[model samples]
Target: MMKVANPPKVSPPANEALTKDARQYGVVIGALAGFCENGSPLVSLGDRPALTAMTLVDVGEQHIGMRVAVQFEGGDLGLPLVIGVVRDNSGVGSSAGASAARVTSECGLSATIDDDEIVLIARRRITLRCGAASVTLDSDGNVEIRGKHLLSRAAGQNRIKGSSVSLN
Candidate 1:
């Protein structure tokens, strides 16, 4: 009778080691490479090739080189999803006391909140509009207020001061 020997078990590819390792089942840090044709983000995990991924947090072209935390759904065979952006801690101590919150839009609108004040910034103009009333502030330092009927009332005094005050 001939002796029979079992074949050796093959190991998984090195790139797939992340999913195979039980210890790495948790969130993994990845760099945002770019976006696919379908708008899905492509992430690079260490030396592995970039893989298309979904994101729970909003990501734009501006965040292409940002670091993000990726979590695999189900298990090693599940899809990869970007959970959150990893904030850079280098500037953590730049603001000592006040905590700031900021929101920026691609259309050149930004709002920032720091301590007790809120500041709004825009590239061209900032306008507040209602039914027939609108106030506009332009980049040229022009302030325009329009309304059907305008009234100025103050508890103590009301003053209208400008380079040249006009009343008609």
Candidate 2:
């Protein structure tokens, strides 16, 4: 892949550019999962794993489950964040969505999916205009880039529930 491409509507998040005090870990979301004690393998086992792919429906359970472990996990979140975009093996939109915007917006930005191309609201905008369409889109066509790298485990408890996915 190219190092970078032309930006969309918005600019990238500032957090990714930090250079100090960063920690990494895996993101898991689903119904139920188990992380290997050795951190080697993750399996679905006809159900789900510790690192599960989840939707908004599972928020309640995920929140309560991490409470006990929050007092034990640790790490730093002040460093640059590098992420890898993740997709279902069959790819996105193929899951048969009901919305006109095939791809859901990450955190409210509009997005859409066209074959393999993902057009999204690039957060890389130089100026922050309230109604600029160039850096602000109103569609559902971005490729959701969810990474496997873990965020800082020491920042507190599991603060991120539906992990922040970027438009790749």
Candidate 3:
């Protein structure tokens, strides 16, 4: 016997469709890289002279972690995460749950993950493009760094062979 043709798939309800965005990425306004009428204020992200949406030029992600490049449109200058800065991918437009903002490194990594850092990924990488100084990993595998501002590494002197590295 010949089988009957399948009917057209039923469309989701309007409210349901809207919920999809809220569930997956987040609010619709926050998702766009442009002005959002009902989105979080620009001040919430950074204190730029003229806050605006940052364009995602590039993105570096690891598992649950992500770093996106935000191109400032001459409005917000010198603002780190707003444009040339890096922050954890955990709370992109979240009003709360912001652990701390992070910065990117030369080794294609994100550092200074806030205690708010999302541990969803084993080891993640974000980018906050900025020029930073170099440190010598001493003979004993210890590098006593000073005046450094890498939030993550500076917190702990991990894997320092023998010498003491005062990160403070």
Candidate 4:
């Protein structure tokens, strides 16, 4: 019987091999280039090609030019993960007064909260619905209200002023 030579040991994939090597390098700073088709952010690390990365912090389109800390996820087969944003010591972006929080949704809805008040915005329409009652506001300056019953109560003066008003 002819002895079969041992098969050559196949190496891991490039990313997998890079992952092992990357561990020793620790976290790297990368800039957010843009977003991928699946909405994941693409980051540029040094001179390498842009790699798709997921974020541990809340990141949006506003963060496209910001630097972020990137590291390979240990259990995720070395997929790049954005751990945090790198903020400069300069107080340029920081507010001296009350801090504000902004949240943007995937569907074009956004909200901003500050010390004074909260603001909600939507591209097309915004609707507030509770049980059988619903209030809809559209970009065309149209407000529609629907409910089983409607009530109008005011502690002070109540006024209904519009281009045209109809009552039944």
* Leading candidate by TM-score: 4
Scored by lDDT, model 2 comes in at 0.27
RMSD of each: 14.0, 23.3, 16.4, 11.3
User: How high a TM-score does candidate 2 get?
Assistant: 0.17
lDDT of 4: 0.69
Ten-residue stretch with the least lDDT total in model 4? 91-100
Cα displacement (angstroms), candidate 4, residue 134, comes to: 31
Residue-level lDDT of model 2, residues 42-119, one tens digit each, is: 112112112322222222322211211110012222211112122356642112222322322222232344456544
Compare candidates 2 and 4 on TM-score and give the better one: 4
TM-score of each: 0.40, 0.17, 0.18, 0.43
Count of clashes in candidate 4 = 0
Of 1 and 4, the candidate ahead on lDDT is 4
Candidate 1: tens digits of C-alpha lDDT, residues 20-126: 66245578877666665578877666555567777899988667556778886544423568887777577311221245545443344555557788776778888
Compare candidates 2 and 3 on lDDT and give the better one: 3
lDDT minimum window of 10 residues, candidate 1: 91-100
Native-to-model Cα distance after best TM-score fit, residue 143 in candidate 4, in Å: 34
Q: Would you list the clashing residue pairs of candidate 3?
A: 80-85, 85-128, 86-128, 99-116, 112-152
lDDT string, candidate 3, 1-168, tens digits: 877699667444446544443355322221111222343213222321223333433322221223233332222232222332234466443222345543332222233446644321112322233356454443353444433565445665656543565755
The pairs that clash in candidate 1 are: none
Q: What is the lDDT of residue 66 in candidate 1?
A: 64
Whole-model lDDT, model 1: 0.67
Looking at candidate 3, the ten consecutive residues that score lowest on lDDT are: 27-36
lDDT of each: 0.67, 0.27, 0.33, 0.69
